[model samples]
Target: MMRYLIALMCFFTLQNVYADMTLTIMDQDNKPVSDAVILLSKESVSTPDAVAIMDQIDESFVPRVLAIQKGQYVNFPNSDDIRHHVYSFSKPKAFEIKLYKGSEIPPIAFDKPGLVVLGCNIHDDMIGYIIVADNSYVIKTDKDGKASLPVKQGDIVTLWSERFIEGVNTTKEINITNDTEQTLSLELLPPIEIMDHSMGYGFGKKQW
Candidate 1:
């Protein structure tokens, strides 16, 4: 009977070490920031096998910003009736899919960790971003700027947003613990530019 109690205690201890945490991000004005990426540092992380999609519709990428684990595949499907050219010159990965309509293009695998700025040769105004991460514990904030994930105590988590100033420190490291607040409010640096979402545009500027 004593051994059974000890085993149960060990199970509870493990649960405490890996607890579910909720993180909230805000801008300098205390407004909930959406589309912010949340990344966790984990030792046993591995590349995901699922293929993500970045579709183009109405001369614009549906989800202007996409977050993916390193070595994951991304399919660029042109939903618009007109042909579009997709390309990126970022260092992490550089490739281009020539003028095409629909999903005829093959999936591109992102093998490195960094931001891949996407653009089109034909449409000068269209822009998109693919943020490749090395760790599997990645989460993007919802419209309310909140995300929940299972995090271990002492684990460091980083946050990224395109709205941040180009040359500023955009990462936030938090030591997770049982006493840590579930809802953390952080004021980020001023944004380089803000897009009019109501007009169907997303975050970030045309520059790399």
Candidate 2:
């Protein structure tokens, strides 16, 4: 009986030792971005399942932007008075939700990893993003543009942005076992010249 009790204690201790790691992300300006998504993955672990995206009212996609595991389903629900034609040319899942007034079509499955840009055929100003990730440790950054990720020592962490320029960026490799807290500061280049209604949608100009 005593040996069994010892074994049980040992099991619990091992479980506690394998706790997840945490990652904190912030922009160059040290401001918290509420909707930034973070993803973590390792070759050894199997990829997580997929999720869904819903299309709601006001001629806008619900959640505005979403990050999900690869193979997840994205549901388009029309909650508006008019019809919307939703489509994406992303290599992962290139499909379209033809003109529909309500929730008539089933959810779309994204089976690969890539950025899926969503748009409405009727509304030229409507835009959204579907980021399909293979990692299980994914999270959307809070209002402070910060994201805490559960990770482990020696794990490879990566950060991505749609507007990330080719060069003029920095990434720091952190050793989790060496320090309890790690802070990274990156300087982003100025925004490129482009014409769009991104300002109307409440997205400010890309300022580093």
Candidate 3:
């Protein structure tokens, strides 16, 4: 009788976790990875209440990276008190915001799902990245590499990061199960180091 009650409690606990699942993302070095985005296989068109903002400050993109759902709008606000010419030639979304300052720039809507590399035509040192997915997923890892993703059986969780190792798979797809452990430590390669050439001045510089 005692054994039967314990088994029943376990079944109930699993059912309760359908909406309270959490995951911890880590790199191959067992260190917490930041700016990692978690997405679901299913797609949703519902937009979140708040709009996304990508600010330009101190000659650099404040967040460096951003992730948003498709059909969402992103505002590029210049807070550096200087002019900026932001543009992206990425296949998903190709557009440019001519030289401007302050928050006068209009918000650009992203309708496709892919990576958008941001660059400043005037500042060779400035760069930023934006990833647009299909849904309003809220599972991006924080500074401590922790995020809560309400998951269900057979759900596929996709992960992506800019710092993922080179020549290796940068994105990951995980299968969900009710019997999954409480913590999941993923193995992603460290970022590839590039030569510091952002400050270089002159023509013929690398263009995004």
Give me the candidate number with maximum lDDT: 1
Model 2, range 79-188, lDDT digits (tens) per residue?
A: 66788898888777899888987666787777787677888889987777787776455667654555655555565566654334453122234444412335544454
TM-score to native of every candidate shown: 0.79, 0.67, 0.74
**Worst window of 10 by summed lDDT in candidate 1:** 199-208
Each prediction's whole-model lDDT (CA): 0.75, 0.61, 0.73
User: Once superposed on the true structure, which residue ranges of model 1 sit more than 4 Å away at CA?
Assistant: 167-170, 177-181, 188-208
When 1 and 2 are scored with lDDT, the better candidate is: 1
lDDT of 1: 0.75
Ranking by TM-score: 1, 3, 2
154-192 in candidate 3: lDDT tens per residue? 677887777665422257787766434344566566643
In TM-score terms, candidate 3 sits at 0.74
Q: How close is candidate 1 to the true structure, as a TM-score?
A: 0.79
Best by TM-score: 1
Model 3: which ten-residue window has the lowest total lDDT? 199-208
